[model samples]
Target: MALRLKDQLVGQVVDGRYEVLSRIAAGGMATVYLAADARLGRQVALKVMHPHLAADEVFVDRFAREARSAARLSHPGVVGVYDQGAEGGTVYLAMEHVPGRTLRDVLTERGALTAGEALAVVTAMLDALASAHRSDLVHRDVKPENILVGLDGRLRVADFGLARAASASTTAASVLIGTVAYLAPELVTQGRADARADVYAVGVVLFELLTGSLPFTGDVPAQVAYAHV
Candidate 1:
C-alpha cells in the first residue's frame, strides 16, 4: 500500500521545471518529493500542497507568503527557499534539498542527548531563530520536527509555514498555531504570540533534549495546551 502511494507521482513534472523523483515525506499540509530541477539541473525538495488546501485561496496565498518570507532569510542555519508557484491546480514550493534527519528522528531513536550535545544543537537552532527575528519574522512553530540535523554536523531550521512578521498582529482566538507541548503560556491563554513565544518554545525544546520528555503531556491536545497556562 505504501509503495503504491509512493509511486503515484514518481515520474510527474511540476510547473514544467521540477521533475518528481521520489517521495520524501508527507505532513498535514503537503507532501515533499525529491525532484530534479530541469532548468537548473539540480535537485530540490518539492513541497506540493494537498489538493484540498490548494483549493483554498487563503491557504495558497499564505503558503506563497511563507516562501517569500523564508527566502528573504539568508542564513546557514535555515533551509533555503528556491521558488514557489501553482501549475494546473498544484501549488508547490521548491526548496534546497538538505540530506539529513530531523531532530525529532534523533530524539526518537537515541531517547536523549548529553548536556553538551544538547547545548550545541540548541545553539545552532537559536542562531537560525536569531536571523529570522532580525528579519522581523517569528517562527511560531519551533519543535524538533522542524529542525534538520545534517550529516556534516550542521543544523538547519525548516518549515516557516507558521511564521509571521513580528510586527503583524499575531492574535487569533479562532486558531491555535504551534505544537501544544512547546506552546507558551501567552499563546495558550491569549492566543497571542511573538518572538518571545519562540524563545519560550526553545526553552521547552532544551528541556526535552536534556530529559527526553516534554515538560507537559496530556491525553488530549487541549489538556496539554491548558497546562502551558
Candidate 2:
C-alpha cells in the first residue's frame, strides 16, 4: 500500500495513468483526488475506494458495477464516469473533473440561497435524477455535498449509484447508512429505497438549502432515526 498523505495526494500515480495532484474531497467510502491523466493529457477526478472498503469483496464488486452503470449516463447535470480499474490493490474511478464549489460549500458560505438559485440547483438535480431513474439507476445518496455547482452556474450530481451499490448486499438489519439528517423516512424505517426515496431526499436537500438547516437534528443515530418519524 502507498503511504497516505495527510493534506494532499501528490506524487502518486493511480493505475499508471492518473497522477495525483491534490486531494479534492473525502467521503465515507472513497477519497477523491484531482489528478492529471497522463495518457489523455487531461484533468480528471479520481475516486479511490478507501482501504477499509477495498477489503470487502461485496463493496468492490458493487463499486465496479456502479461505475459501469454511471458511465452509461450522460447529461449536462450528471458528472460522467470515464473509466474504472484496480491497480496495486487500489480501486480507482476516473470521472469528469468538475471545476466549481460544492453545493454544501456554497450553502455554508452563503448561509441560505435565494429562491431562484435554490430552484435552479434543485431543477438540475432533479433533471439528473430523472435521467438516472429512466435508466433504472437509483442514486441513493442525494445531498448538498454531492451536488456540485460548476463555474458556469450549472449544477451537476456526483457519486451516482455509489452509496446504494455499496450497501446493497450488506445486511441492513442493524446498520443505518447514509447521511442522517438527509435520509428518507422510508429508508430509515423500512429499509426500502426506490426512486420515491430519492425524491424524498431531494425534498430534504431543498428544505435545507432554503432554511439553512436540516429539518431534523439529533445527537445519535437512533435519535436521528426517531426524528425521521
Candidate 3:
C-alpha cells in the first residue's frame, strides 16, 4: 500500500497519551489512525488534520473547539469524539475507533441496494444526524464517504470536520467545505447551514442508495455547484 506523508506517524505518540499504530484512511481534510491510548489503556481512532491545513491557526482553533463540543454529544449512531489536542502544529482528535467500511465502499462494490436495505442504511445515518440536530449541531457535510458501516453491520455517521452549530453562522466558512455532490443548495448560495441542510444531504444520500447515482452530474465542480444553486 502506498503511504501518504501524513501517515508517517505509524509508531509515534501524540500528546503523550495516544500511540499511533497504523493508518486507517485519509480524507480531503484529515487522516485517521488506529492508536492505543496509553492513559486510558484503550484503543482510539486518532484523526489528525493534514499538516498543510493544520498550519492555519484559525482553522486549527476552530477544529479543536468544535471537536471538543462534539465530544459532549452522546449517541450510539454518532461516532463518539473522545479528546482533542494539538501538539506542536499537528492538531488531532481522539475518537471512538470503529472497524468498518464506508458507505462509499459498499456502493462501489455493490451497486444499488434494495429499498429495504437502503432504508436501513439511511435510517441509521438520519438517526445520528437527528441527534446532532437536537444538540444544535449541523453536520454540514454528509455523504456516503462520511457514513460508516461497521464490521458487525451497524451503521454510524462519522466526520464532523465541517459541522457547525445552528447559531454559529455569524461568519461564513473560509473555504467551500463538503463534497460538492452532496452539498445543499443554500449552503452554496448563502453560506449558511442548519438542521435542514443536513436533512437535504440525508435526502441526497438516500437517493444515491436507491438509484446508485448522484442527483446532479457535471464534468467540473463549478458545474455541480451551479446545478446546486
Candidate 4:
C-alpha cells in the first residue's frame, strides 16, 4: 500500500495560542482539527481556512462573519465560538469541540431513526435556529452535516459560515450558499433566505431522519437544486 501523508498542521501552533492536535475532518472550505488552547488549557475545534481560500478577500470576510455571527448568539443548542485569528496565512476559528459524530454519520450508520429520536433531533435544531433568527441572523445552510451530536446525547447546530444577517438580500445570481437537497425553493430560485429557509431545510432533514433518504435526488447537484425550485 502507498504510504499516507501526514497533515502539516497537526503539530503546529496557530497564532501562538491553539496547538493543533489532529485533524477531525476536511470540508470544501476548511479543515477542522482537535486543538489545545494553551491560555485556557482546554480543547477546541479549530476550523482553519484553506490557504487558497484565505487569499480571497470574499472568503476571508465570510470566515470573519462566521466568528462574528456565532459569537453574537448564546444558545446551548448552538456551538460556541471561542476565538478567531490569523497567523501568517492561516485563518481559523476556535470553537467548542463537540465530541461525537454528525447527524449525517448517524443516518449513514443507522439508516433511519425512530419517531422519538427524530423528534428530539429536529427539536434541538429548531431551537438552535430560533436563537439565530431572534438575533437577526439567517443560518442560510442547514443540513445533517452541520448538526453535531454530542456523546452525551446533546444535539448542536454548527457551521455558521454560510449565515448572514436577515436584512441582507441575496440573489440567485450570487454564488450558491447551501446544500442542494436541503435548499429552500426561494433560495434556489431567487437566492433569498431568511428564517423560513432554515425551517424548510430542517423539515427536509427531519424527513431524511425518519425516512433514511432525501426526498429528492438527481445525477447532478443542479438537478437537485432545480427540484427545490
What is each predicted model's overall lDDT from 0 to 1? Answer: 0.80, 0.81, 0.79, 0.80
lDDT of 4 by residue, 1-229 (tens): 0011116788888899998888888764568889999999999999876666666666666667767878888999999988988877787889999999999999999999999999989999999999989988778778998999999989999977443421132332233433788889987777676789999999999999999999999987889888877
- Residue pairs with colliding backbones in model 3 are none
Cα lDDT tens digits for candidate 1, 1-229 = 3244357668988888889999988765568899999999999998876666676676667767877988898999998999999997788888889998999999999988999999999999899999989888888878998898888979999977543421132232212333678888987787677789888999999999999999999887889999988
lDDT of predicted model 1:
0.80
Error of 1 at 33 (Å): 0.9
Task: List candidate 4 segments past 4 Å from native.
Answer: 1-6, 163-178
lDDT of 2 at 138: 86
Minimum summed lDDT over a 10-residue window in model 3 is located at 165-174
> Which pairs of residues clash in candidate 4, taking residues 3 or more apart in a chain or in different chains?
none
State each model's C-alpha RMSD to the native.
Answer: 3.5, 2.6, 3.2, 3.8
Q: What is the TM-score of each candidate against the true structure?
A: 0.89, 0.91, 0.91, 0.90
lDDT of 4 at 182: 87
Higher-lDDT candidate among 3 and 4?
A: 4
The TM-score, computed over Cα atoms with residue i paired to residue i, of candidate 2 is: 0.91
lDDT assessment of candidate 2: 0.81
- Worst 10 contiguous positions by lDDT, candidate 2: 169-178
Highest lDDT scorer: 2
Model 1, C-alpha of 6: deviation from truth (Å) = 4.2
